[model samples]
Target: MFLQNNEIRDLLNQVADLLEIRDDNPFRVRAYREAARVIEQMTEPVASLVKANKDLSQYRGIGRDLAAKIREIVETGGLEQLRRLRQELPVSLLDLMQVPSLGPKKTAQLYKHLGVASLEDLERAARRGQIADLSGFGEKSQQHIIESLGRVKKSGEKRLLWSDAAVHARALEEYLMDIEGVRRVRVAGSFRRGEETVGDLDVLVTCGRDREKDVMEAFVSFEGVKNILSHGKTKSSVILRPGLQVDLRIVAQVSYGAALHYFTGSRAHNIAVRKLAQDKGYKINEYGVYQGEKRVAGKTEKEVYASVGLTYIPPELRENMGEIQAAADNRLPALLKRSDIRGDLHCHTRRTDGHGSLEEMAHGAIAMGYQYLAVTEHSQKVAMAGGLNEKQVLQYMKKIDAINEKFSGFRLLKGMEVDILADGRLDLADSVLAQLDLVVCSVHYQQRMDEKKQTERIIRAMDNPYCHILGHPTARLINTRDPMEIDLEKIILAAKDRGVILELNAQPDRLDLPSSYCKMAAESGVRIAVSTDAHSVENLELMENGIAAARRGWLTRNDVVNTRSLSELLRLLRRP
Candidate 1:
């Protein structure tokens, strides 16, 4: 199998985690972790680069040694080093480390002292009060472990994040398009709907009748296929490495649109549309819309919608959430697009945990045609990210001024992603915050407060006059960490009242301010800032994902604060 960059990145990260568990040299572990990050953020596939004989060492964290390792994985589809590491470590330790609060050290301790080798064993130990007797794990830790085990058990089949899924989807699409007689190919289902996570891929294709068998054969024989679940002349299902299932279906050209519609569905949306078709005395199926056995509309999605007395609806809005009514009323929003974004409000630099320098980041924004960019580095509260102290922030402001002076048309706004302390205090003083162009307040710690306290903490933070935006409002990492306990409605109402722009953080894992909440905030007259929260120059591209999320929420260009020009955005921000 041709290894995708993500697969290699995952293998490298697993190697690093295992190394940490084995108490290897910290720098060696960091080397693997950094290489993984470099691969993860690369816009180009490492395999292609390797095929072209490009110098991988030019990448941020990849040195000559790491470059060789990457090539080995790309060419061979496996890393002998990682395989050996796996052989040495208990494989279950990896799963155990995924539990919240269970770091590599703790995992190692559990393995060494208590012989806790797997989640099941750990659960048993915790239930029997054996975990509490361990060297570092007390009764409270045991309870926390038990709670986390329940969460892990509940989080069933892993779903790929949209960004991760896009890589695989595009690769498969390209792979299938190369077949001789394939007419059209589309990836349907929640992925097509731009959902945050997708359970599997539904690939729909149109091909000549004679080519159907050939297409199915080619699909199941693809390089990435791990196992064939089922095979047929027109339909085939296969499981890829890492356990993502893909189902491929071949349809006639005439039934392509109908099949696409049927496959690209939220069950509710499909049911509603089918009922509408039935009410109009037409039978709709994956093949076509039939009027008493005579084919009517099926060749195109537009015709399918036209048959139902409605204009075509974009796939992102196909959640059956009043979209049909909105379509009938001609009230479907002109959703925000990537080109509509004029600036980025939340980004980081090397002064914090970010990899890029201020100049590199500014150049990246300029390349994207952004009129302005905000350098919102972490505040002192997040010291692990090398957050700046008061003096450091002032000095950084001087540096930004220098850079701003260097550029004629572009502007760099001095901003800080300040921490909202547990007691509802800003990490930086008002005097310090008042000096900046903007402040993006967020909760970095104390995420487990009771609902009232968490809500109140956020509300108080929003109430601060200098707080212009709320960064990653819920602090949820998709499929991993659950959103903190808080009344989001109360927080949204407070943001509306305070004129605090809610952020749709564009980082793939932290696509916070989910589509549904974005809709609520939009309806409440709260504007959203779809900022990348970018840590590197490459990460600025994540804005597209943010725009996708906004479109899914039915937000228009006017609903996004950064879609406005500099002066207009500043005016919005300055409103007290």
Candidate 2:
């Protein structure tokens, strides 16, 4: 039984969430949560280490107690303590956390004070006027809860981040390839199309006909499968531990390409392609493309495209969004690739809320082959991050300059994620801003400003000569909060007019500058800075997510600023 790191991490997080719900020791809960984060970030499999008898305690956050808990989970697929805690706390209480703005602390208060055990219970309490009377949750809080319940129900079928799904998909790929007769395995569907959130994973496989039953059996036994939905000789499906449902289909190698094309679809894209095939006197399906009762093209995806007289479309562009026409016109974009990114422009250091020191982040950038790294710490407007004042910013700039002298072929660009004050003025003065390599201004607070005010506020910041880019432009958190009401199109126009770049934040929850808006920016001739907004060394790896998001937006090398060499990038940031 092999468990992926994310699988282990998710189970650990469950324990943490449970502990916090019951008002357990804060340090104890943090330990489990930290251990989970360490495991999730690990490239190596925790299950493999346990099998090898390696001491998991060697990992930074995993202590003796945490290591023992991990061992129990690895050996038995669950932590005994988590099961026991669920019994005492009414596991359904955890479900209450799904409501927007309703956190564990609030949930605990609700449960303790009102016997609220589920979403239904909470709704009843709020509707009965009991919640508004409670401490902390006044009329507005009760109203917000009432408003958010519908969203919770509508979004009940939880989705996994594409990155998380990829981890499981890769594990499944290795597992299937190890089978005696498996020929090829590829996870299709939105995963291939690189949607930010995936409803489920669809894996297509090709294998020896004689081994079809064996493949199906092995798939069901996949280590992370939480429940087996079905089992058959040629097809099977299972729900993984983290609530991601995966389906497996064994096909002959002859139809692999056709099956893959059909599976890796936006539905609308597939429909568009079928229309093309029909017009070409061909019928395309999962089996093969038929030419009036004769098989014509099916061996490869490129062949599938050629049969219809079109170039092969990359999966990221298969959104039925002018891609087919673009392919016919030979206008498909040369989309951005991971290798195109040369530096991370929006990194934070220990000077603020980040866990990494200047030297540590510089080394991490070096490890990732980055030519430069912009240490963009928050300004004083964000008091929670211990945002830096002018004095602190000046001190950090000197540190960056000193640090740069020590490393050849690497530079630490002094930058700040300055706040765009509610009235549209920058938080920092030009005296300090002029001393930095770049300035990334963002709206960290007052996110709920009316659309007109929000739009004007960001546009006003773009007018600042020192502002090089806008960070997480829309301020939306995936599955948690909706995007700010700022007119992204207006912002894009302003960025183009003022030479400000827009950021594609790579954080899993905040893949802001959603691909659609990114497309808007690119088409307007505004460059994007695909920064990880990394707080720690490990967070820099999130550039992969940003690159994926960038490609989805039809961005290319020339469309991104950081893709340039250090000299070229510095030249670009030079303001008029």
Task: Give the Cα lDDT of each candidate.
Answer: 0.90, 0.89
Model 1 steric clash pairs: none
lDDT of 1: 0.90
Position 257, candidate 2: lDDT: 86
Residue by residue across 1-576, what tens digits does model 1's lDDT show?
578878998899888989999999999999999899888888887899999999999977899999999999998888898889889988889888657778788888888888999999899889999889988778878998899888788867677889888888998999999999888999999999999988899999988888888898899898888999999988899998868899999888898888999999988998899899999999989999999999999899888888998888999999899999988788889988888999999999878988899999999999999999999999999987889999999999999999898998899999999999998889998999999999999999988777899999999998899999999998988765668888989999998888899999998888889999999999999999999999899999999899889999999998999998888988999847
* TM-scores of the candidates in the order shown: 0.94, 0.92
Candidate 2: global Cα-lDDT?
0.89
Candidate 2 displacement at residue 156 in angstroms: 3.8
Candidate 2: tens digits of C-alpha lDDT, residues 269-346: 999999999998999999889998898888788889889989999999899999999999988999998788899999
Quote model 2's TM-score: 0.92
